[model samples]
Target: MKILKFISVLAILVILVFSFWIYRSLNAPYSHNKNNQYIQIPQGSSPGQILVKLTSEGIISSPIPLKIYLKITGTGKEMQAGEYLFNSPITPLEVLSELKSGKLRTVKLTIPEGFTRFDIAKRITGQFPQNQAAGEDAVLKLTEDISLIKDIAPQAKNLEGYMYPNTYNFPRAVTTQAIIKQMVEEFKKVWKPEYADRASELKLKPHQIITIASLVETESRLDEERPVIASVIYNRLKKGMPLGIDQTAVYIAKMENRWDGVINKSDLESNSPYNTRKIIGLPPGPISSVSESSIKAALYPATTNYIYYVLNVDKEDKSHRFYSTAAEFERGKAAYQTWLKKERK
Candidate 1:
């Protein structure tokens, strides 16, 4: 009887010790050198593989206990795969909870209004250094594939103005082509079917409308002025006169890879088709990404005979004054030059 009692007591004590160890292991914090670490749980990674990776990275002390805990709690099969950020000294339970939450790491990229495809490519490269192997040149090369925008803009040379500008959250390992596709898809969403009918009414193709919208976008920041700017462009086209838009000179400089923000005399006189000062019609392509308001203005221009516009120096807002006659335009031009010289001084 004494022997039996002693054996039962020893077994109970061993059970208590084992239970305490399991509890402590589950609740104990992991040891890590870094305060925060990013771990990529690759697709199709098994629970065992995840445990091994966590243990190897010093995110968890022992894999066995975590594996057992996960299995017992039915969370082992629920582990998701993606980029996960882990703070140091995280408990096993917390780690499991985080994994179960399915919150993948993402980078927020904001493409402001009027950003060109070239500008978008530069921003993407800056945001994702891991893609350094494919620099601006490589990205530009990818934009040349017009298949993504062919349905909406069959005549598009490339996705110049079709890359919709908006904020996007992308995964860390997303491909450049995928990002371009997403932007183009967003543009499609914003482009309504009615715009196509309006394009036909203006006797213009979708690409031409987008090109005009780009010109209007670069010329004015005011939404109300976009239609007026669009009217000026249309009037010039109708009269077979050169658009003479300074923004086109800037676009030419960019195309030749010589843009320095300051337009030289040569830029205005350049024989490039993109130079609106020298060319009689619309540019061969869009100069920049356009906004919805600009697109609307391009489709529906205001009824006006004014063919000239100069920056209105009298107003604090950067607005323009329209003139129908050459004499009035020259006067406005003189005032603008005077203001320009004074501002420079």
Candidate 2:
């Protein structure tokens, strides 16, 4: 009986040692020296399916060992779904824990091109609204309360064009006014010394240049065409002619809350000094915030004796045809009319 008991004990000890060795071999840390790879666990993938995928991709050696480890570690129920990039050799337990944490992938928020001040304000406001800051109108409204920026653009009645459009990475916790200040600071940073020299050469104040640039920015989508439009404005200025910019009249109509979709004869004849038809030499201030290309256009206008331009409506493109005389302008206008009739048809 004693001999039998001793043999049984020895067999039990050997089995225990071998079991430990097997566990260690199966659950060893994974080594991935290649480029960091994205691992996607589809939503609703069972633990068994996940294990198979991990084993096939060399992310793990075995699923059974991982299951035991997870049961011991108490992190089995916390797994989340999303794209994840594994950077280096790590135990299966570590990767599982990381997926469970569900940390977000920080990304940049990009603002699209050709957005106006109202558009900018609406965008910012939508992100952080009045209720976010004690009944204030928007994130931009918080800027108005800051005394320092109130006088930033004296000519601009409100913070319309000052909010420069660009991509920004705003974390979830950022405050209302801080966002506005960031945009203003960004604009100032981009406004260079060369721009100031160019402004001086064109006999325009920085503020005035911004206004015209805003107009040019709104006028055309093509960067190449801004200089030509700038020349048209300058030619009109030299000839003591009314800018005849329907946009300006439309601006006034919008301000008065009486815009009837189009600028009628009476709208252009309004008594405001801002009415370019009544008083020439660029309105009292810039109508809107301008862009870099428009600023360049304002600085360097095209050299042309042409005094008039009408849309090349005959062509599929919306570009204008420049004319040196009223007769030529009339001919171009007639062609535009013919094209307009066909388009309507």
Candidate 3:
């Protein structure tokens, strides 16, 4: 009986010691590396190998405790391989959680609404890896391959309005093609079947709807104002009048690789089919990326006689004042020009 009692007490003591060790290993904050240090775990790496790598990099004091903890918990099989950024003072448990999440450390690239293909290409070229022909021009050329979006935008000459603008976190080694592909895929996700039905109901092609949406996106930032701007575009098109959107001229300058942050008179007078001032209908294609709100606005514009919109300098939100007559538009334009001059001063 004494021997059995001694064995029970020893077993209890061992359990208490193991529990304490695990609690310290998993919960205790540890920092042996520089703050925000990154480590790459290669594909197909075993849990043991990964734990050892972390120990060698001083990300953890030792991997033995974690190994024993993993053995007890049965939770290491889901760890993913990727570049991981470990912030200092992170617990081993926290690190394990991050690994299981499978979200590799990524560099975020944000493409704002109304950003043209040129804008995206330039941003991608500057931030991501490029091939031997590494240049902004080369990156722009990749967007020309419309095979990825050909199903929906069959007549698309290039992926101008198709690269959906959003902040995307990509792996460090992500190629320009992969990045562009992901953006187009995101656009597909946003361009739902209902949008297609609405476009058909309005007697507009998918391409035309996207083009009008792009115009609306550039014209107004306010969701409420986008439908109004879309109405203006449709109203002008129905009247067989030029769209006269200045952003198309800006897009032209960008296409010519001479956008010097100023829209020259030459740009306004350019005979490019994309020049909305010169063209009678919608530009040849979308001039910029279209937000879903802009797309919705194009599909369902406010029923109005509005054929013109000018920046409302009086409003704090920078919304537009819509007008049905040239005379009303001229008055709004005069106020906007005055505000512009004063701001320049």
Candidate 4:
């Protein structure tokens, strides 16, 4: 009986030692000198398969403790698939906890202050080809091919100006229609119902507001100046004056495929509806995407008596001193020339 008891104790000790060894080995961190790396867990890979992969990749010391830990923690059925980044030493236990939580990597995309529907469509297309989303051609077709967008945006003629500019995180499996709907819905949410009523008061169409907003968006990168520039467009319109926006000329040049880097005298005289330098009132449609600020500026312009503005000579970005006469504007223009000379230097 004594010999049997001694043998039983020895067996228990051996089992405990092996269990400890497995846990420590599997849960050990990558060494201090280890390189930064990422682990990709393929979709639907079982715990056993993942363990085999990790062991082979040198991410874990051994699969034994990993399997044992999963079994012990009741997480064998909870692992998820995605790419995981590890900059510092991370233990198998840490990785398992993160994976079970389904924390996937995310990327950021920034749409600038001014973008046209066409420009935005191309940008979305570039990102979607690699993912599950519809290809660019298909999405753009949905825009002009009303059948594709009717379900997404009933009010939108084409997807033009409907895609709201903002940072977005597109999941790997997100569909094309889903992406378009999200952007248009976001734009709808920002547009106030009262703004429509206000447009009625001004006898202007909502489309006209968007057109002016696009001009404001292109006119200045300075957020504070958009409303003031919008006021200039509005004041010019009230008096039946030409908008004379250089951006419109550029747009015409781009459309005609004659655009060089610099705007020339011929572009200013181009006979296109979008040629604001030649035509009266706002352009036919929005030339580019607009931001909320520019839209608000179009809705409510600055209350000012002045209609003329020129870039400040000493400081082009500094607010223009509003002017009612060309002489004042010319003086401002002279200061702008001196500043331009200094800038070129």
Clashes of each: 0, 3, 0, 5
**Model 1 spans with C-alpha error above 4 angstroms:** 1-33, 101-104
- Across 1-345, the per-residue lDDT of candidate 1 in tens digits comes to 999999999999998998788889889888687456678788899999999988887788888878878777877878888777887778887888877766678889898878887788889989977668778888888888999988878888889999888899998778888988898888888899999999999899999999999999999999999999999999989999999999888877877888888999999889988988877899888888888999999999999998999999999888999999899999999999999999999
lDDT of 4 at 45: 93
Report the number of the highest-lDDT candidate: 3
Output the number of the TM-score-best candidate.
1
TM-score-superior candidate, 3 or 4 = 3
Alpha-carbon runs more than 4 Å astray in model 2: 1-114, 127-156, 256-269
What TM-score would every model get versus the actual structure? 0.86, 0.63, 0.85, 0.79
lDDT of 3 by residue, 114-173 (tens): 999999988887777644358888888899998987888889999999999999999878
**lDDT tens digits by residue: candidate 2, 40-84:** 667787666766767777777677777766677666667765556
For model 4 the TM-score comes to 0.79
| Local distance difference test scores for all models | 0.88, 0.67, 0.89, 0.74
How much is 267 displaced in model 4, in angstroms?
2.5
What does candidate 3 score on TM? 0.85
Worst 10 residues of 2 by lDDT: 143-152
